[model samples]
Target chain A: AQSVAQPEDQVNVAEGNPLTVKCTYSVSGNPYLFWYVQYPNRGLQFLLKYITGDNLVKGSYGFEAEFNKSQTSFHLKKPSALVSDSALYFCAVRALGGSSNTGKLIFGQGTTLQVKP
Target chain B: EAGVTQSPTHLIKTRGQQATLRCSPISGHTSVYWYQQALGLGLQFLLWYDEGEERNRGNFPPRFSGRQFPNYSSELNVNALELEDSALYLCASRMTGSHNEQFFGPGTRLTVL
Candidate 1:
């Protein structure tokens, strides 16, 4: 089955410091990985996705993620953390081939990032 | 372009009652997907609709069903709602094609008492 795992339930970082939110996935074939952030009482906002191109993918709000095929990991990274960046982050994966080409995403449990001022 | 939109931003219902949630996909988008985000269950796909047809569904029960209209908008109906059914129901949309990412709506907060 296709699945995503965000090992950390919470991550803490100081403002202006670099932050990394780890994610690893399992799927039957090549995977489509995505990162999304959700604020309290709001829907998820798309951050970035790795389809088939360059491994380093950049997205909205100064966020980026690195796709490592060997390790099956796509970790979200930010050069500098901000208080506004503190939110619930989710890692999702969708399989590319076979019967799992339904385009439905399998999401991780989510990670909460706390950026201290 | 306008993004996906959902109705009844917040809903409160009692156990055994039914709930209906609606969604309008972004213009020119033909695929609409529904997901449930319960407290414990992170985010699970509920149903997928494209071009007025039900394309796929998740591991949910028959009580959890939905349909897509001719305009490509959709509605999800949950029968015999239980306390566990209380969750944030999210609606997402994408163009009918490969390698397309879905855009989500604000979501409907359904509370079952």
Candidate 2:
């Protein structure tokens, strides 16, 4: 079984300030984690992923996520937030070496990021 | 490169009717995935197709089904739709050897009246 959790329904931060959105996962095997951003009425856009190695992975739009094995977390972060960064963020996971090799993702409920200028 | 594309950006169907949503994967990508994003429900995996075969399905009932054509494009058919079926139906595609980074399309907004 694989699952992802975005603990916060929303996160607010001011422009030029650092921002973080929390995500945690539970999977039977090594986890394949991903982050996506969705604008209003737009499809999800891939941000970054953590498959293996490099606990810290940088992604599009100056966003990054750190994979914590012991803590079971993959939190998205940005050094400086911009108003345009405001959007719905999603965390997803898939267990590697699972019975099914299909690329099926189990998504988190999603976190709405609000970057106020 | 053309990303995944879904047809009929918005669909309206009455209860007990059937809805068919289509998707065309990116060039060279062979895997297609379907998901439902209902209001407040987030994204629920619906189906997965690779190499023109149904690879896996979610916990949806038999009424929710789909197929992949030889070209790797796919279609999702929802039979006997209910009001609760109203949601954004998303289609994504990924390369076979990729690390499950599925690129998504704009999606088809399915509204069951």
Tens digits of per-residue lDDT for model 1, B25-83 = 99999999999999988999999998888889999999999999999999999999999
Tens-place lDDT per residue, model 2, B79-109, is 9999999999999999988575999999999
DockQ-derived CAPRI band for the predicted complex in model 2 = high
Scoring only chain A, what TM-score does candidate 2 earn? 0.96
**Which candidate gets the maximum DockQ versus the true structure?**
2
Clashing pairs in 1: none
- How far is each candidate from the true structure, as Cα RMSD in Å? 0.7, 0.9
Give the lDDT of residue A51 in candidate 2. Answer: 90
- Per-model DockQ against the true two-chain complex: 0.85, 0.89
Q: Give the local distance difference test score of model 2.
A: 0.94
Residue A110 CA error for candidate 2 (Å)? Answer: 0.3
TM-score of 1: 0.98
